[model samples]
Target: MDDEPIWDVDRVVALTPSSAITIPETTNEFVIKGNHLTLIKGNQLDGRTKTDPHKHIHEFLRICDMFKYRDTKNEVVRLMMFPWSLTGEAKTWLDELNEGTIDTWDEL
Candidate 1:
Protein backbone atom coordinates (compact mmCIF):
# COMPACT_ATOMS: atom_id res chain seq x y z
CA MET A 1 0.00 0.00 0.00
CA ASP A 2 2.90 2.39 0.57
CA ASP A 3 3.56 2.52 -3.19
CA GLU A 4 -0.11 2.74 -4.16
CA PRO A 5 -1.93 5.91 -5.17
CA ILE A 6 -5.13 6.57 -3.30
CA TRP A 7 -8.22 7.12 -5.51
CA ASP A 8 -5.91 8.39 -8.31
CA VAL A 9 -5.51 11.72 -6.54
CA ASP A 10 -2.41 13.69 -7.41
CA ARG A 11 0.38 13.57 -4.91
CA VAL A 12 0.97 17.30 -5.12
CA VAL A 13 -1.49 19.90 -3.96
CA ALA A 14 -1.56 23.41 -5.34
CA LEU A 15 -0.91 26.16 -2.85
CA THR A 16 -2.17 29.71 -2.72
CA PRO A 17 0.52 32.18 -3.69
CA SER A 18 1.73 35.02 -1.54
CA SER A 19 -0.23 38.21 -1.93
CA ALA A 20 0.94 40.62 -4.63
CA ILE A 21 0.08 43.64 -2.47
CA THR A 22 3.18 44.87 -0.73
CA ILE A 23 2.81 45.75 2.91
CA PRO A 24 5.08 48.57 3.89
CA GLU A 25 7.71 47.89 6.50
CA THR A 26 6.76 49.00 9.97
CA THR A 27 8.71 49.72 13.13
CA ASN A 28 8.68 47.09 15.84
CA GLU A 29 6.67 49.43 17.99
CA PHE A 30 3.87 49.75 15.47
CA VAL A 31 0.80 47.72 16.32
CA ILE A 32 -2.63 47.35 14.75
CA LYS A 33 -5.24 47.54 17.49
CA GLY A 34 -7.95 44.92 18.03
CA ASN A 35 -10.69 47.48 17.51
CA HIS A 36 -9.42 48.20 14.03
CA LEU A 37 -9.70 44.55 13.06
CA THR A 38 -13.10 44.40 14.69
CA LEU A 39 -14.32 47.32 12.65
CA ILE A 40 -13.05 45.87 9.39
CA LYS A 41 -14.48 42.44 10.15
CA GLY A 42 -17.79 44.00 11.07
CA ASN A 43 -18.08 45.43 7.59
CA GLN A 44 -16.87 42.40 5.63
CA LEU A 45 -17.76 41.89 1.94
CA ASP A 46 -18.66 38.31 1.07
CA GLY A 47 -19.36 38.94 -2.67
CA ARG A 48 -23.04 38.11 -2.44
CA THR A 49 -26.39 39.81 -2.97
CA LYS A 50 -26.70 43.43 -4.12
CA THR A 51 -23.85 44.67 -1.97
CA ASP A 52 -22.28 47.71 -3.61
CA PRO A 53 -18.55 47.12 -4.07
CA HIS A 54 -17.85 50.85 -4.22
CA LYS A 55 -19.74 51.48 -1.04
CA HIS A 56 -17.95 48.62 0.62
CA ILE A 57 -14.61 50.06 -0.42
CA HIS A 58 -15.55 53.49 0.91
CA GLU A 59 -16.58 52.01 4.24
CA PHE A 60 -13.35 50.05 4.32
CA LEU A 61 -11.43 53.25 3.72
CA ARG A 62 -13.31 54.93 6.53
CA ILE A 63 -12.27 52.16 8.90
CA CYS A 64 -8.69 52.40 7.70
CA ASP A 65 -8.82 56.17 8.28
CA MET A 66 -9.58 55.67 11.95
CA PHE A 67 -6.05 54.52 12.61
CA LYS A 68 -2.63 56.01 11.97
CA TYR A 69 0.89 54.75 12.52
CA ARG A 70 4.03 56.81 12.34
CA ASP A 71 6.13 53.99 10.93
CA THR A 72 3.83 53.15 7.99
CA LYS A 73 1.76 55.07 5.46
CA ASN A 74 -2.02 54.97 5.65
CA GLU A 75 -2.12 53.45 2.19
CA VAL A 76 0.08 50.63 3.41
CA VAL A 77 -2.23 50.05 6.29
CA ARG A 78 -5.19 49.87 3.95
CA LEU A 79 -3.42 47.35 1.73
CA MET A 80 -2.46 45.20 4.67
CA MET A 81 -5.91 45.35 6.22
CA PHE A 82 -8.17 45.08 3.18
CA PRO A 83 -7.85 41.30 2.89
CA TRP A 84 -9.26 40.80 6.35
CA SER A 85 -12.65 42.04 5.18
CA LEU A 86 -13.37 39.35 2.62
CA THR A 87 -15.16 36.01 3.02
CA GLY A 88 -16.30 32.96 1.05
CA GLU A 89 -15.80 33.21 -2.75
CA ALA A 90 -14.32 36.68 -2.49
CA LYS A 91 -11.53 35.41 -0.30
CA THR A 92 -10.99 32.37 -2.51
CA TRP A 93 -10.63 34.55 -5.61
CA LEU A 94 -8.04 36.76 -3.98
CA ASP A 95 -6.08 33.80 -2.69
CA GLU A 96 -5.90 32.39 -6.21
CA LEU A 97 -4.13 35.39 -7.77
CA ASN A 98 -0.47 35.05 -8.73
CA GLU A 99 2.16 36.44 -6.42
CA GLY A 100 3.52 39.91 -7.25
CA THR A 101 0.60 40.59 -9.60
CA ILE A 102 -0.69 43.58 -7.65
CA ASP A 103 1.76 46.16 -6.39
CA THR A 104 -0.60 48.91 -5.29
CA TRP A 105 -4.03 49.64 -3.94
CA ASP A 106 -5.06 50.95 -7.34
CA GLU A 107 -3.90 47.66 -8.88
CA LEU A 108 -5.90 45.71 -6.35
Candidate 2:
Protein backbone atom coordinates (compact mmCIF):
# COMPACT_ATOMS: atom_id res chain seq x y z
CA MET A 1 0.00 0.00 0.00
CA ASP A 2 2.93 2.33 -0.74
CA ASP A 3 3.55 2.80 3.01
CA GLU A 4 3.28 6.55 2.41
CA PRO A 5 0.79 9.16 3.56
CA ILE A 6 -1.09 8.82 0.27
CA TRP A 7 -1.74 5.19 1.07
CA ASP A 8 -4.24 6.29 3.65
CA VAL A 9 -7.81 5.01 3.57
CA ASP A 10 -9.32 8.42 4.28
CA ARG A 11 -7.58 11.73 3.68
CA VAL A 12 -4.81 9.89 1.87
CA VAL A 13 -6.69 8.71 -1.23
CA ALA A 14 -8.29 10.64 -4.14
CA LEU A 15 -11.46 8.59 -4.52
CA THR A 16 -14.37 9.32 -2.17
CA PRO A 17 -12.58 12.59 -1.49
CA SER A 18 -15.28 13.59 0.96
CA SER A 19 -15.57 10.16 2.48
CA ALA A 20 -13.34 8.96 5.26
CA ILE A 21 -13.41 5.61 6.97
CA THR A 22 -13.07 5.74 10.74
CA ILE A 23 -10.94 2.96 12.07
CA PRO A 24 -10.98 2.22 15.76
CA GLU A 25 -8.08 3.53 17.81
CA THR A 26 -7.60 0.05 19.18
CA THR A 27 -6.30 -0.79 15.71
CA ASN A 28 -2.54 -1.03 15.60
CA GLU A 29 -1.92 -4.03 13.39
CA PHE A 30 -3.47 -5.08 10.05
CA VAL A 31 -2.55 -6.90 6.80
CA ILE A 32 -3.68 -7.74 3.26
CA LYS A 33 -3.10 -11.13 1.73
CA GLY A 34 -4.37 -10.90 -1.84
CA ASN A 35 -7.61 -8.93 -1.39
CA HIS A 36 -8.58 -9.92 2.15
CA LEU A 37 -7.38 -8.13 5.30
CA THR A 38 -6.95 -9.18 8.91
CA LEU A 39 -6.82 -6.67 11.76
CA ILE A 40 -5.55 -7.44 15.24
CA LYS A 41 -5.81 -4.66 17.74
CA GLY A 42 -5.03 -4.25 21.46
CA ASN A 43 -1.76 -4.16 23.41
CA GLN A 44 -0.34 -6.94 21.28
CA LEU A 45 -0.06 -4.61 18.25
CA ASP A 46 3.51 -3.60 18.97
CA GLY A 47 4.36 -7.26 19.18
CA ARG A 48 2.74 -7.98 15.82
CA THR A 49 4.97 -5.57 13.86
CA LYS A 50 8.17 -6.81 15.44
CA THR A 51 7.40 -10.29 14.19
CA ASP A 52 6.54 -9.37 10.59
CA PRO A 53 9.35 -8.26 8.26
CA HIS A 54 7.04 -6.40 5.92
CA LYS A 55 7.72 -2.66 6.30
CA HIS A 56 4.09 -1.54 6.45
CA ILE A 57 1.57 -4.33 6.60
CA HIS A 58 -0.85 -2.10 8.46
CA GLU A 59 -0.90 0.37 5.59
CA PHE A 60 -1.65 -2.41 3.16
CA LEU A 61 -4.50 -3.63 5.30
CA ARG A 62 -6.01 -0.19 5.53
CA ILE A 63 -5.52 0.48 1.84
CA CYS A 64 -7.31 -2.73 1.09
CA ASP A 65 -10.22 -1.46 3.15
CA MET A 66 -10.24 1.85 1.28
CA PHE A 67 -10.22 0.36 -2.18
CA LYS A 68 -12.30 -2.71 -1.25
CA TYR A 69 -15.86 -2.88 -2.56
CA ARG A 70 -18.50 -5.37 -3.62
CA ASP A 71 -18.26 -6.79 -7.12
CA THR A 72 -21.07 -7.53 -9.60
CA LYS A 73 -21.44 -11.08 -8.31
CA ASN A 74 -22.33 -9.78 -4.85
CA GLU A 75 -20.15 -12.29 -3.08
CA VAL A 76 -19.98 -11.40 0.61
CA VAL A 77 -16.36 -12.34 0.38
CA ARG A 78 -15.76 -9.55 -2.12
CA LEU A 79 -16.00 -6.86 0.57
CA MET A 80 -15.05 -8.92 3.60
CA MET A 81 -11.80 -9.81 5.36
CA PHE A 82 -10.91 -13.41 4.63
CA PRO A 83 -7.72 -14.90 3.29
CA TRP A 84 -9.34 -15.69 -0.10
CA SER A 85 -12.21 -13.23 0.14
CA LEU A 86 -10.76 -10.28 -1.80
CA THR A 87 -10.97 -9.57 -5.53
CA GLY A 88 -7.44 -8.15 -5.95
CA GLU A 89 -8.94 -5.54 -8.27
CA ALA A 90 -7.84 -2.55 -6.21
CA LYS A 91 -4.23 -3.66 -5.94
CA THR A 92 -4.06 -4.33 -9.70
CA TRP A 93 -4.03 -0.63 -10.68
CA LEU A 94 -0.90 0.09 -8.70
CA ASP A 95 1.17 -2.52 -10.47
CA GLU A 96 2.95 -2.52 -7.13
CA LEU A 97 1.37 -0.59 -4.24
CA ASN A 98 1.13 -3.62 -2.00
CA GLU A 99 4.86 -3.86 -2.59
CA GLY A 100 5.10 -0.36 -1.03
CA THR A 101 5.52 2.11 -3.93
CA ILE A 102 3.54 5.00 -5.40
CA ASP A 103 5.72 6.70 -8.01
CA THR A 104 2.62 7.95 -9.82
CA TRP A 105 0.03 8.45 -7.08
CA ASP A 106 -1.82 11.39 -8.59
CA GLU A 107 -4.32 9.11 -10.31
CA LEU A 108 -5.48 7.46 -7.08
Candidate 3:
Protein backbone atom coordinates (compact mmCIF):
# COMPACT_ATOMS: atom_id res chain seq x y z
CA MET A 1 0.00 0.00 0.00
CA ASP A 2 1.13 3.51 -0.72
CA ASP A 3 1.95 5.66 2.28
CA GLU A 4 -0.53 8.35 3.19
CA PRO A 5 0.72 11.88 2.69
CA ILE A 6 0.96 13.89 5.91
CA TRP A 7 0.43 17.27 4.31
CA ASP A 8 -1.73 18.95 6.89
CA VAL A 9 -2.69 19.13 10.55
CA ASP A 10 -5.68 16.80 10.21
CA ARG A 11 -3.60 14.07 8.68
CA VAL A 12 -1.03 14.50 11.42
CA VAL A 13 -3.63 14.23 14.18
CA ALA A 14 -4.90 11.02 12.60
CA LEU A 15 -1.74 9.28 13.69
CA THR A 16 -1.86 6.84 16.57
CA PRO A 17 -0.86 7.97 20.03
CA SER A 18 2.39 6.08 19.82
CA SER A 19 3.31 7.89 16.67
CA ALA A 20 5.27 11.10 16.85
CA ILE A 21 4.40 14.08 14.66
CA THR A 22 6.50 17.08 13.84
CA ILE A 23 5.64 20.52 12.52
CA PRO A 24 8.82 21.85 11.03
CA GLU A 25 7.35 25.29 10.55
CA THR A 26 6.57 26.19 14.13
CA THR A 27 8.03 26.17 17.63
CA ASN A 28 4.86 25.04 19.37
CA GLU A 29 4.70 21.45 20.54
CA PHE A 30 1.58 19.49 19.60
CA VAL A 31 -0.41 16.77 21.23
CA ILE A 32 -3.43 15.13 19.61
CA LYS A 33 -6.37 13.31 21.05
CA GLY A 34 -9.39 12.22 18.99
CA ASN A 35 -8.91 14.86 16.28
CA HIS A 36 -8.23 17.58 18.80
CA LEU A 37 -4.81 19.16 18.78
CA THR A 38 -3.33 20.95 21.73
CA LEU A 39 -0.40 23.30 21.35
CA ILE A 40 2.04 23.06 24.19
CA LYS A 41 4.61 25.67 25.10
CA GLY A 42 8.37 25.10 24.71
CA ASN A 43 10.15 22.30 22.82
CA GLN A 44 8.97 19.56 25.11
CA LEU A 45 5.85 17.57 24.36
CA ASP A 46 4.94 14.94 26.92
CA GLY A 47 8.33 15.18 28.59
CA ARG A 48 10.25 14.89 25.33
CA THR A 49 12.21 18.04 24.68
CA LYS A 50 14.71 19.28 22.13
CA THR A 51 17.37 21.72 23.18
CA ASP A 52 17.56 23.50 19.83
CA PRO A 53 16.25 23.55 16.30
CA HIS A 54 19.03 21.23 15.20
CA LYS A 55 18.05 18.63 17.76
CA HIS A 56 14.40 19.15 16.89
CA ILE A 57 15.18 18.49 13.24
CA HIS A 58 16.85 15.26 14.22
CA GLU A 59 13.77 14.25 16.13
CA PHE A 60 11.55 15.22 13.19
CA LEU A 61 13.66 13.20 10.81
CA ARG A 62 13.33 10.17 13.04
CA ILE A 63 9.56 10.54 13.29
CA CYS A 64 9.12 11.04 9.52
CA ASP A 65 11.43 8.08 8.80
CA MET A 66 13.43 10.31 6.48
CA PHE A 67 16.86 10.02 8.01
CA LYS A 68 18.25 7.73 5.34
CA TYR A 69 17.04 9.98 2.54
CA ARG A 70 17.75 13.36 4.10
CA ASP A 71 20.73 15.37 2.97
CA THR A 72 21.75 18.92 2.03
CA LYS A 73 21.17 17.99 -1.64
CA ASN A 74 17.42 18.20 -1.04
CA GLU A 75 16.65 21.86 -0.62
CA VAL A 76 13.20 21.43 0.92
CA VAL A 77 14.50 19.06 3.58
CA ARG A 78 17.44 21.36 4.16
CA LEU A 79 15.14 24.31 4.74
CA MET A 80 12.81 22.38 6.99
CA MET A 81 15.68 20.93 9.00
CA PHE A 82 17.41 24.24 9.56
CA PRO A 83 14.73 26.86 10.00
CA TRP A 84 17.17 29.02 11.97
CA SER A 85 19.02 29.56 8.72
CA LEU A 86 15.98 31.18 7.14
CA THR A 87 15.43 34.91 6.81
CA GLY A 88 12.50 36.71 8.44
CA GLU A 89 10.45 36.60 5.23
CA ALA A 90 11.23 32.93 4.80
CA LYS A 91 10.17 32.23 8.36
CA THR A 92 6.88 34.04 7.71
CA TRP A 93 6.41 31.97 4.58
CA LEU A 94 6.92 28.78 6.59
CA ASP A 95 4.36 29.98 9.12
CA GLU A 96 1.89 30.59 6.29
CA LEU A 97 2.63 27.13 5.00
CA ASN A 98 1.73 25.64 8.39
CA GLU A 99 -1.49 27.69 8.59
CA GLY A 100 -2.51 26.68 5.06
CA THR A 101 -2.80 30.36 4.25
CA ILE A 102 -0.56 30.23 1.19
CA ASP A 103 -1.83 28.51 -1.95
CA THR A 104 1.52 27.45 -3.28
CA TRP A 105 5.19 26.99 -2.38
CA ASP A 106 6.01 29.64 -4.95
CA GLU A 107 4.14 32.15 -2.84
CA LEU A 108 6.98 31.98 -0.28
Best by TM-score: 1
Whole-model lDDT, model 2: 0.29
Candidate 1: tens digits of C-alpha lDDT, residues 66-97: 88877677877888888898876466556666
Tens-digit per-residue lDDT, 1-108, candidate 2? 233222333433333322122222322333334333433121012212123323334543454445433331212222223222212332222332333232221212
- Would you estimate the TM-scores of all the predictions? 0.77, 0.18, 0.21
- C-alpha lDDT (0 to 100) for residue 18 of candidate 1: 85
- Which residue pairs in model 1 clash with each other? none
Give candidate 3 misplaced runs (Cα > 4 Å): 1-50, 66-93, 96-108
State the C-alpha lDDT per candidate: 0.74, 0.29, 0.32
Ranking by TM-score: 1, 3, 2
RMSD score of candidate 3 (Å): 16.9
Predicted candidate 3 versus true structure: per-residue lDDT over 1-108, tens digit per residue: 123222233432221322121323433433222211111112222211222445544554444343323232333333333333333333333443434333322332
lDDT of candidate 2 at residue 106, scale 0 to 100 = 27
Off by over 4 Å in 2: 1-55, 71-108
